[model samples]
Target: MRTLKQALLALLVLSSAVADLPTEMPIPEAFIGSPVGTASL
Candidate 1:
């Protein structure tokens, strides 16, 4: 149980760290051409 908790904590920290990194992937032209608020929920 303790190991499971530790693993979850580590995963959470790593996920947050990765989320903070800048996205290197290119944005599709369709997404760029789409007007703002067109896809908003």
Candidate 2:
């Protein structure tokens, strides 16, 4: 169907756009509470 083809095309464009985004996300400040050298388990 024409709608199905349109949907697939839109999905392809969206996926390609998402793939171009920077992969490395910065850690949020709230999650970085531990002091530099210490490990919490």
Candidate 3:
């Protein structure tokens, strides 16, 4: 019914909106480096 159609429409809109987001998020500088004595994996 009507509710199912509305749910599908809402999902379509949400998915489209999410698809427009940036594919590559920038990494924060703090996580990119470690202190002089510490080892990074």
Candidate 4:
């Protein structure tokens, strides 16, 4: 159980690190050409 908790914590940390990186990393240029839909909820 302790090891599982530690693994979950490690995963959470890694996900946060990835999300903190620049949002401008290369992506399909066409993705930007089409407007993103808005959320209604």
* Candidate with best lDDT: 1
* Better-scoring candidate (lDDT), 1 or 4: 1
Q: Considering only N, C-alpha and C atoms within 3 Å, which residue pairs clash in candidate 1?
A: none
Instruction: Provide TM-scores for the models.
Output: 0.53, 0.51, 0.50, 0.50
User: What lDDT tens digits, residue by residue, belong to model 2 across residues 1-41?
Assistant: 99688667655654565466456733333224323212212
How displaced is residue 38 in candidate 2, in Å? 45
Judged by whole-model lDDT over C-alpha atoms, candidate 2 comes out at 0.46
Cα error of candidate 1 at position 16, Å = 0.4
- Which parts of model 1 have CA positions greater than 4 angstroms off? 25-41
Q: Model 1, range 1-41, lDDT digits (tens) per residue?
A: 99688667655655565566457733343234333212321
Q: lDDT rank, highest first? A: 1, 4, 3, 2
> 1-41 in candidate 4: lDDT tens per residue?
99688667655654565466567753333234323211111
Q: Which prediction has the highest TM-score against the true structure?
A: 1
Clashing pairs in 4: none
Task: Please identify which of the two predictions, 1 or 2, would achieve the higher TM-score against the true structure.
Answer: 1
Q: Which ten residues in a row have the lowest lDDT in candidate 3?
A: 30-39
Q: Candidate 3, TM-score vs. the true structure?
A: 0.50
lDDT computed for candidate 3? 0.46
The collision pairs in model 2 are none
Worst 10 residues of 2 by lDDT: 32-41
